[model samples]
Target chain A: MKSNSSTVKTRPTPWDALVFAAVAALAVLTALVFYGPKARTNAPLTCVVSVGGEVMDHVPLASFAGEHTYSHNGYTLTVRVSGGQVEVLHSDCPGQDCVHSGPISRAGQSLVCLPAQVVIHLESGTDGPDVIVG
Target chain B: MKFSVKKLALCAVLAALALGLSTLENLFPVSLIVPLPGVKLGLANIVTVFALYELGAPEALAILVTRCLLGGLFSGTATALLFSLLGGLCAMGVMILLKRSRRLSVYGVSVGGAAAHNAGQILAAMITLGNTMVVGYLPFLLAVALITGTLTGFVVSLLLRATAHLHLTNQSDYR
Candidate 1:
């Protein structure tokens, strides 16, 4: 056995560097375009109802701010409405994408972390979409 | 010709280790130098990388799946699970594909798998949101994938080296 520390050199290949650069560029570009000021005011603010998975057509989109638990099939969705934002505070699915999506309030504003098959969307009406969470 | 207790024990230990790594990584989120959304080191994948080389794909899948499921219970929001599952499946598929192709080294396989995982997760996000706008964030995810994948691969290599003598007698060792 020898201490192979005398002549050691580690260098990243050109292709590796290129891949890193490309990926970095893409991440920066995505943040710029999606979070840009222009996307902020695309539509007048409105309420949205996004339901999918198990719960049938019963969730009232108008009274979205209180703590409510909606269960359908095997999935569970707990919504917490604060101020104007409505968000999934808890769910029983395998992926926790929904909880990490933060809060969504503005009309046309939506956030979904899909591993749980949960969907969050803004509906225009103060009443109903007759939505089914299949 | 029979499965040995030693083999079962090794698998059990590896599975536990993998789960532990997943939990540990989830403790703190690493914000990268680049301000890209959903980019991180994925330190738990280090165990997955090691499992791929040492225990093979099926074992790795078991460990990864157990970690993903139980992990979701701890801190992950629902959306996280969807993203992780999509990413893990894509990564596993890519690993299998590369495994079939004799040209790729373990490191290469790891990188490919990591990249696939990120791509898959991002694609899932895009589909769920019904917006293609998320695609723009891909480059950042890729960057995270490449760097973390390479590091994880390197760690796996070191682990393999340290455990070189623990060779079990099996026809399908694949090494």
Candidate 2:
């Protein structure tokens, strides 16, 4: 408390650097643990749409073979749940991050619209990325 | 509850500023820049940090809660409200603790808040989505938080220095 807290001293101290490094390490470790290599399977993929943990839609990935639209909280989203992939094609949500997530073909992948409380995830038995290095 | 007129007016203005910033941040073309899901600059955090340092903890908390509620109404989503409230509270709690500790600078406090906000959002998602798979993305989100938090801390530092003369909060009042 020698000086004031409103000064121009913004240089991150060594401790600050250590905190950043710790976060980075934690990130890497979590990635490795969560996305580690899993046994891939050729089983069929099922697309599930859940809102507030309630299943709104569940269909075989290729059964739809068309654009399916879902709306919540005054926002609309168009998703492609066919052609061997599940992806959000368009959304009126402000962030549009879900739309930008591209398509998820393998199991354990998800497209989440936080604003709408919607989660569209691909599920399969014993199916995940065979290789997820780094 | 019983406050000076100046405090009341300042809280209203700060809350409004935070709300406006939240709306503007949502409009940011973050997809083009980060191409990551559920990530953004969190521009509203700037106002929260400013208020924490200049106005005091209660004022900052009030402004944050007000902003979240108003932002939820503006977005017309209850789910978003939950996430905002959770994330805002988590970030605020961490920043307040760090600020009180006086062990780290604004950079550390801001960075810690950003990371906490993201983690809180992910936790909210897990509860709403009823699955833990979303945790896989936590690493990526935290990585981005570091950079965004650094930028926010830089801006807060600048604002603190530039406006130090005003002395909105007496030195002994908050410190």
- Which candidate has the highest DockQ of all? 2
Interface RMSD of each: 8.1, 4.2
lDDT of 1 by residue, A1-134 (tens): 01221111123334444444555565666555555565444433344434565433333344545886656547887878777678888888777777877887544456664654555666444333212111
> What is model 1's DockQ versus the real complex?
0.12
Off by over 4 Å in 1: A1-134, B1-4, B32-34, B168-175
Give the Å error, residue B125, model 2: 0.8
- Indicate the docking level reached by candidate 2: acceptable
Per-residue lDDT of model 1, residues B80-139, tens digit only: 777877888888888777655544455666677788889888888977887554565566
Candidate 2 lDDT over residue span A78-117, tens digit each: 8886668888899888898899889888778889998877
Estimate how well candidate 2 is docked, as a DockQ score: 0.28
Please name the candidate that would achieve the greatest lDDT relative to the true structure. 2
Per-residue lDDT of candidate 2, residues B1-175 (tens digit): 4456777888899899889888888887586777786788988999998888777788899999999999999999999999989988999998898777555778888898898898889888978987666777889989998998899999998888777777565444334
